[model samples]
Target chain A: MAGLEDLYREIILDHYRSPRNRGELPTPPAQRVEGFNPLCGDEVVLFVDLHDGTVADIKVSGQGCSISQSSGSMMTAAVKGKSVAEARALIRRFKGLMSIHEQALGGEADQLDEDGADGAGADDPDVKLGDLEALQGVVKFPVRIKCATLSWNTLTQALDEAPA
Target chain B: MTAVEAGRKAATPLDVARVQADFPILARRVHGQRLVYLDSAASSQKPRAVLDAMARFYETSNANIHRGTYQLAVESTEAYEAARRAVARFVGAPDPRGLVFTKNVTEAINLVAASWGGANLKAGDAVVLTEVEHHANLVPWLMLKDKLGIELRFVPMGEDYTLDLTHLDRLLDGAKLMAFTAMSNVLGTLTPIRRITDAAHAAGALVLVDGAQLVPHVPTDIAALDVDFFGFTGHKMCGPTGIGAMWARPELLEAMPPFLGGGEMIRDVRLDGFTTAEVPTKFEAGTMPFAEAVGLHAAVEYLGALGMDAVREHEVSLTAYALRALKERHGDDITIYGPSEPAMRGGALSFTYKGIHPHDVSQVLDQKGICVRAGHHCAKPLLRRLGVGATTRASFYVYNDESDVDALVEGLSDADDLFSL
Candidate 1:
């Protein structure tokens, strides 16, 4: 019953309504990458500027459902100042959080608590997920896990494509 | 006789109560509410008859077809071929021999693209297609064009949402094939088949009709329509998944190469060169989905017994009612796509509610046990043409009634309130 509430969290809706880093950056120093979820027609064009082996500016532009659009918005905010390696590390952390939450929720409980209930490895005392952890509940809605991770995957690809 | 007794004696054509009885899923609840299933355009719910038919086949005649000499295998082969014949007659094919069983409509169209398209379409050859085609029809042709140098000319959409036939002659001119959908699954626009077929013929181009949306809703006669190849899936018409059919002209079937190379499609086994089996068998590669085919046969019988005309009649009335009910309640807040007239379309209705995104609307509806499809609906190009990211579509079937429409309207109202607030 609370699954929809968990999915469409107030923070998620706010990001969806008024997204951050919502436009493209020029292509000279920026590498542009596109991610598409053909099933739902969701797409993200992520622009990243990597200078001197560090991430300078990140911008996201696209149209999609709340889950995808909001995740893209949060992703830009979380990774804007981090180095390319740090951004990749955050991607791993977020994906690990989603996987852990998925295992905890099981099939019957399609909703996760605002904070990880079983603490889902959060008790490690070293995992500080920041704003990106808001997406941990996305694992409850299994179909939309792709939506929550689309931009991060695209960012990974963008980094891989860019030269060292 | 009493009024109620007299009314009961006449007997409705659909006997919806009886129809509902045939689908076991209809009896189930969703989200603690009555399951008002309206997502048939995505795929139809199977009737008990189809399910039983498949189960009975597995129980009685469980063997590989076309290879074994045992009695069970012969029975399996007959059942498979009988389903083919049933599908052929259901679509009013001039001859059942041209029927080729495919996995689904997408596979059927792909078979044509690889087999027929690859053979005939050389460099500089042109193919005409409409803008409203499902990705299943458009993407394969694009892939073919990428492999072979060919041109794809599109028929533009009119402001009224139907195909603008004014420039159709120009599009078809010099085109080797005019491939289009008989009905738009997104907009519910029933494209004029006979007119398009005639124009394509006059332009000296063969006609290929994607009947995935049309055959399930209307009475189809391939001979009368003068189409070269007609493609459709079984699941959209109360049949099971994993089975579909393509009715192509006998000559075209004979002329094209085998699409998939496998054990069943070849006549002689030689590593250097193999001779292909004839027509339908040639196209049917590997062991067929005979159980699903048996289920599809039962579905065809179910529809045939109800009469396609009656099915169309029931759907039109229901669609018209739903349209009026939705518009009447919402007024200008609702924007419905495709043709406004029910006669000019099928039961599928695509629309946006209260300027809320279709995904949001569908999510809200899902909470209420009202099933509807949202997103590009496998017709992304069409949605882009319409200047929308996605649409929420509620399609009607034989078992759907006025109450289902009411539930849909109620669900939309809930969605509007949830978003607007």
Candidate 2:
């Protein structure tokens, strides 16, 4: 029996109960992006605002199973008020951590020929993905990894397509 | 042997002792009590017979089929072909040549969509599919539509979850193909296949029936129904996993090009080009799952011995009892989707408790050792039409009886009590 404590840690439940950046920002400046976990029918709409070169605001709203919803809530809290470059670095680090291929993050940074030259690597050095490290346990359960990464993936999409 | 003799000779109707013995998993306690499996629609419990068939094949005659001349190779090829024959007979197809084995029903539909559909359907051609189709059927055609510029149309369902065939005739105009489910996995409505097929044929359209939900419970005759294509999975029909069959008319299969090109599906390879093999062999690309095929054959024989008619009767009666019992217990608080008449539906039932989320319901049911699927159930469009994000589904199978239904009712009551709504 997988303990509820192991699968649904206290931090996860807390995020689900009282999500951070849980509502939509105003229009004109923010872009709305929707992501779905087709496996468990988890959906999240992320509203991201870009001010100059920084992510000025981010809000997430959706309905899903606890893992997905909490992951979304945590994602918003983690990336809010960061610069675009910093947010991208955080996403890469988070993905690498979730996929259990930490080396791939280093490989991806090297492969980004354009970004590689600009010291994007040095600017956002491989900082330990703190609370997000909890999701590293999801790799053992292949099916649940999607639940953990759905919001992060959505965040990436919102950031990529965000109006410059 | 006559159907009556077959029924008499078959094993008892999945009694507690028989069920416990056949499914090794049932002996284990999940959340404390014995596991009450009600998610057969997702996948069925494997019997010892099917399991042993695979093991026996692998232990003795494991070889790549149809390529080698050795004794083991010959035996493996024979076993695989015998499984094809069993599948053909199981679905009442005239020739085994018409059946093509794939990984599962999803791959089967994709084979048709990519090969036959891609070849024949043109820019203005329309594909008529039902709203209740699983993503397996829906996505493949959508992919074809995007690639080939074909129009994808949907046949609407009534509030009762039955297909609205009155508008089907109108929608059939300029339709090239009609793909639909014989029974919905979620709502459990049994679509009128005969009428739908006949009307589609009259409209000069090909019909493909998704029989993943239908083949397990009911006796199906492809020739009698006059459907052009039928797809079903092995695991759902008491067979081993990783095998499924698609039955097409021999002529239609001959007309269509091969779905996949590889070792088995080739006849002669030259430096310039290669020639394709026969009807079924042309469709089977790589090395087939020989052991899985043998297990599927054993599964078909097992179902035949039990008799599909009796199985259907047992399920219909059980579904009726379940509907009545759940409705009695929950009253107006429960919203059961699909037809009220069990005879008009299959064994699955998707429902929503007024105040409870389906995930919460499923979690509570899990505590009671009752396993039911909770989600959109791979039918997002249909769920959206039903105005719900998700629902909890409890599906029944041959092993299920009245007691299982009682357990489900008890579990739901427990859920309601815990939620206090």
Candidate 3:
């Protein structure tokens, strides 16, 4: 029951009201990606610019529930000015926070990407999700877990599509 | 009972506590809170009678009909046919043979589109539908338009969410069929079925009344509405799923070709040719839904015992209560999406709170064991026309009382408190 109280904190609502990096980056260099959750009609579009294998800038625009839209704001703020690898690391941590099991939901949970790396959970002692941990309560509301992760998942796709 | 509970019991006309007792699920909880179900517009919770009827059928007489000569088979066949007659009578259609059982309302609509539209419609023919139709009613006709080159005209909607029929005469001109829902599932707007039926008939077109939302809540008479087709499903009416019916005139059914072809739907079959069975059987195809039909029959009896007039009267008062409570409590923060008057709507209430997304509202409501529908509700075009992306709908039913509406109000207030700046 205490977990339910933490699910919608004042910070999350503040971000939902005044979102950070809440627009698209202007230029051809930015890689754009769109993600939609047809279940609730939540949509998020992410724009990113990769400079020297790092995220030079990021912006997001979309309409959705408080959780998803606020998550978009937090995600843009979390990964901006970080290395592309660091952004990927943040995504991995974010998903781990939102994941139901210790392993990822799909059968390929154990399969590491080309980096030959460990499938580490976001609770890693060295790397923390920081303020994004506020969203850890999302796992409590199974139906709304997708709303909190739509932006991060869409941002991951934007990273993949970004130019090296 | 709690004080709030006693207050609601006094406010509501029906004995909602007794009604709730008939549904075992109402005693259960969602998210560790007492369940407050408000999605009956989607489907009603089954009463014990419907459940017992189904269990009794499966326990005693679960057998294929029309073929097996054993006692169980004979009993099953009798029960199935009796269910059809019960359903037909419940809707005030005189002849049971005039009813064709389909899997659900979507299938029933598709059956009409495929069978009647296939046979009667040509490239030049047109079908008139409303802007507020559910996908079940809209998609089949759109598919028909794709298959054949028929023109599909739509009746636009007013700001209040009812159909704007200023040019309905022109829209119905040269139309072979006029299909519409008796009630709008999204906005809870009750369409003027009698007026629309008269207009469609005057325009020389047949009509289909999608009663999926209307039939369960009100006393419907196909003869009084004077529509050619009455489509509805059983699941939403407190019966089991997998059974629905379309009531049409016997002569009209005789004229339309069979929708699905299978063993039960044929009088005789050969490699060379086959003869289709009579009206209902010709449309049913394969083995019918025997047990679900029994449950639906029990549902008819349950509703009849409650008296459809009283059932409707209770909801009318409940809707009025909800509308006033939500408005008086939240004011501009809450925006209901249907007619301001309770007379012009069913129990389904689609609305939004400030700018908080409906999904979030539904999620919060679910925490309080308040179940609601959030999204376009399979009526994307209507939602788009309403200038909103999605809405949270808290619909009422026979089991709902003033407490349920109070629960909804409390939940919405919670939504605003948690999400507001």
Candidate 4:
């Protein structure tokens, strides 16, 4: 039996208990994007403020399971002061982390390989993940992979809608 | 003895261990633990008899039904109609000719909405519904309201999680139809179908009962209930998927147009026009699931041998046990949603634990091989009404026993330990 400790790490529980950057940002200065897992009715609402090629501020407010809310919390903390390009790279790296075991599970590895590689051919493999690496265990449970990536998907949408 | 007294006297409890043995999957282990399946409301595990009947149909009498004059085809047709007859008798319908087989309950309800509602209803017609309906019952009427400029009114739920009938008279006033569920899939709230049908008939309206959750768990008598239409699926009652039934009054079935046009549903077809078939065949369009029908026949026979009254009695006692056990073990940390009385509801128990998200709770329980559904349960409107995103639902069936409930309760403590913070 696969242990629950693999999925629910202590750090993940801590993040779930006290989510970081958990609130709403004003709509006028912040671009908002919402992501929903229709399978489970989990929602992730993101508000992003971009200025001078940097993510000036970001906040997450939504209701979901522990993996989703904790992932959103970690995502806001990671991208709060980073450049947009850096955040996009981190998104690629984080998605790579989530999909690694999914590929091993005989899923659509080819399509994910294509999606993971940007024009740069690699997502800067040396990128530091910090606490985000804890979510890599979510790949063991494939259904929950979406829960972990929901916030990042919403972040991608927010970046697309945010003014450059 | 009167029928009620006889029924009560004959409500012998089921031998759950033997019943569990009839389902092969219950013996299988999940995650190195006993598989405690509590998600029967979504779909049930098929017994050995149902599985064998379906295989036997394909092996012995596999042929397209209704048209062929050959030996195998005739046998196939007989078996299919016999299944229909068995299901009709099971639900207390007077005639099998009024029952039409569709893919599932959702399709069954859609047939009524599109075929009957489309032909009979016009703009400004009102359809009264209740707040406790699954999306299968609610969305069809909503689609009709959009297409035909009709009005839809809902009977709200009281604080007790049952429908508040205080305004039912006003809601049914001048309505063209009243469509609702006999049992709620989310909260396990059983509606008073006979009373509501009486009111609808008195108000000069038709009634359609969504029996997807009701017929599987309790005794259903469509004729006694006096409803115009009754829809339910086979998979939730220990039968295979891809087969469901809709029973309607003969006159309504005769008056309604065919839902899907195809080979079996037509009497004759020409380039200019075509004539529809008789009542039941008029609605059945394609080469239907004959094997699934065989499975359903065996399933109903299995239930009949066990007796639905006994099944209902067993669930009532089991639900009462679960309700009390959960409350006693968890105390205020748990919030179960539904009517408190087991007789008023079925075995579905939707709850929240220690303010933890339902998904997380279900994930932890999964480690212990406990299968419970954790989601909006296709009742988003009702969940929104309750102001919760989702709930963890543990529903019981004929095969489940108190041991499964014990596993679930023990598994919750595991969840609490990990996510208590």
Tens-place lDDT per residue, model 3, B209-328, is: 899999999888887788899999999999999999999888989999888888799999999999998888888889989899999999999998887777888999999999999999
Individual DockQ of the candidates? 0.44, 0.26, 0.51, 0.83
- Per-residue lDDT, model 2, residue B148, is 91
Residue B226's lDDT in candidate 1: 90
Best by lDDT: 4
What stretches of model 2 exceed 4 Å from their correct place?
A: A5-23, A49-58, A70-149, A152-164, B1-16, B413-421
TM-score of 3: 0.90
What is the descending DockQ order? Answer: 4, 3, 1, 2
- Name the docking class for model 2: acceptable
* Model 1 spans > 4 angstroms off: A49-56, A83-85, A100-124, B1-12
Best-performing candidate as measured by DockQ: 4
The 10-residue segment of model 2 chain B with minimum total lDDT is B11-20
lDDT of 1 by residue, B269-374 (tens): 8769999998889998898899999999999999988878778888988999998999999999899998889989999999987767787788788888889998
Evaluated on CA atoms against the true complex, candidate 1 attains a DockQ of: 0.44
lDDT of 2 by residue, B78-101 (tens): 999989998899999877899999
Question: What would the C-alpha RMSD of candidate 2 be, to one decimal place?
Answer: 4.9
Model 4, span B1-421: residue lDDT tens: 9998686666767888889989999889989989999999999999999999998889999999998999999999999999999999999997788899989999999999999899989999999998888999989989998999889999999999999999888899999999999999999999999999999999999999999999998988888899999999999999899999999988889989999999899989999999999989999998999989999999999999888988898999999999999999999988999999998999999998988999999999998999999999999999999899999999999999999999999999999999997
